[model samples]
Target: MLDYLVFIGTGVYLIMQTLGGDKVRGLTIELVRFTLAYSFLWGAIEKFMQPDLFYHLLEEHSYLAMGMDWEFFVRAAGFVEFCCAWHIFSGRAAGYAGIGLMAFFVIAAVIPFGMIDFIGHFLFIIPLIAVLFTPRKVPLCRTACGTTLAFLVALALYLLVAYAAWYMLYFYLHLDLFH
Candidate 1:
């Protein structure tokens, strides 16, 4: 329902922006960048503000071991997310930042299990597609195209592997919900 709408809306927006190449495209790009910044900044803040909650979230995630010391990783992840968020909001190299963050997210999606993992994968779609369809300040060349293709290929592979891992872990482990 909502997902379908998002898919269609993004697709149409990308096509129009990519082809039209106008002020509207620039605005769209800025919007995407700001959105990422807000999202990541909030996520980083939340992770530290509620350590207990995050720890509980990790426990439910299944892929991460129960006793693993997550203090440093959580803080580090928060900082990295904040940096990425700042880069995005500033509208400096948004495409490159989006691509880098999207790749990082694709990796993170495969790291955990359950619906959260799937959500992470689906979340990357918007940024990745944004990078692909947005008109860049610098004209894209053949080498850039090849690089994009390679990243997409890697993303797909990671997705397949993640799904399989989730399925296997879901059946083997009885994950308890906190709320």
Candidate 2:
């Protein structure tokens, strides 16, 4: 949904980096971060919501899923994506998480789905790199109770955001595609 924003933000970021527009560069990076976080969170929601779809997909196409437990794998994948999303949002340990996420995207999505997945995920690559390398300017507090509360609140709020985004896309695309 926000693929364009990621692409444009990344371009502006690179340009600003070389041209000395510090504020513009920072803003673009933030834009990339927010979009990537949203994308990862949405993907996690899908994994959590429909394990059967993912399971059948892997079983049908992936040789790796031949002997492994599909159910456990799906849940674990969802949890990993959720963690990646949260780290991206919190801007804490994002580099660590982002690298894992990029690998996951390549191994899980692009490799299995091929060209379609590659095209869909192309914009994500740069944004993930942005979050991976650029530390947050105003970092979120990890020690404070209020900061913890705020982060939790943001997580809860994202549920509604996800729902709203779903409904917004419902009319434009086939809902059965996600199923």
Candidate 3:
């Protein structure tokens, strides 16, 4: 199944990174960073577009309920996620963003959705952990201009890939995402 492939592929990727040499480790870390950025960006956009899903979840399950203004909480959360994704993508305090997101997930898993959400999001924790452990170095582009160009290119590529994946899931597979 596709789910099994994802799990196995992730495990294999992590294992490769763990046993890899220094260059391999660096590449893998960058890969993980890009992946986290892409995922968070997509998630933030989805939350902003379809806030009712998160609003309902927070109202029904979250311990820190927002009561009548639940939509505010949803939008706030989406904004934070968007900011974190930007930070990660731009190589600006990316590790801090990863750590913050990790903490948020820990709280969410404990205070709201419990084991099911925890298990479902367990794979997400891996990249965050990797980002936390990875050293903060200059991005592949050394100069300011180069860095800006690289960031723009990376963002564009990530958005395109994410959109393609979404299209495949929604149109081809007929998966009812976020429902």
Candidate 1 off by > 4 Å: 1-23, 60-68, 91-98, 114-116, 132-179
lDDT winner? 2
Q: Local distance difference test, per candidate?
A: 0.56, 0.69, 0.64
lDDT of 3 at 1: 27
Taking all chains together, each candidate's TM-score versus the true structure is 0.51, 0.67, 0.64
Which ten residues in a row are the worst by lDDT in model 2? Answer: 1-10
Comparing 1 and 2 by TM-score, which wins? 2
lDDT per residue (tens digit) for residues 2-121 in model 2: 433555656666777788776576776777777677667667777766678897788677665556788877777776776677677677665466557655765576766788878777
Off by over 4 Å in 2: 1-22, 62-69, 144-151, 160-179
In model 3, the clashing pairs are: none
* lDDT of model 1 at position 152: 54
Ranking by TM-score: 2, 3, 1
Model 1 has an lDDT value of 0.56
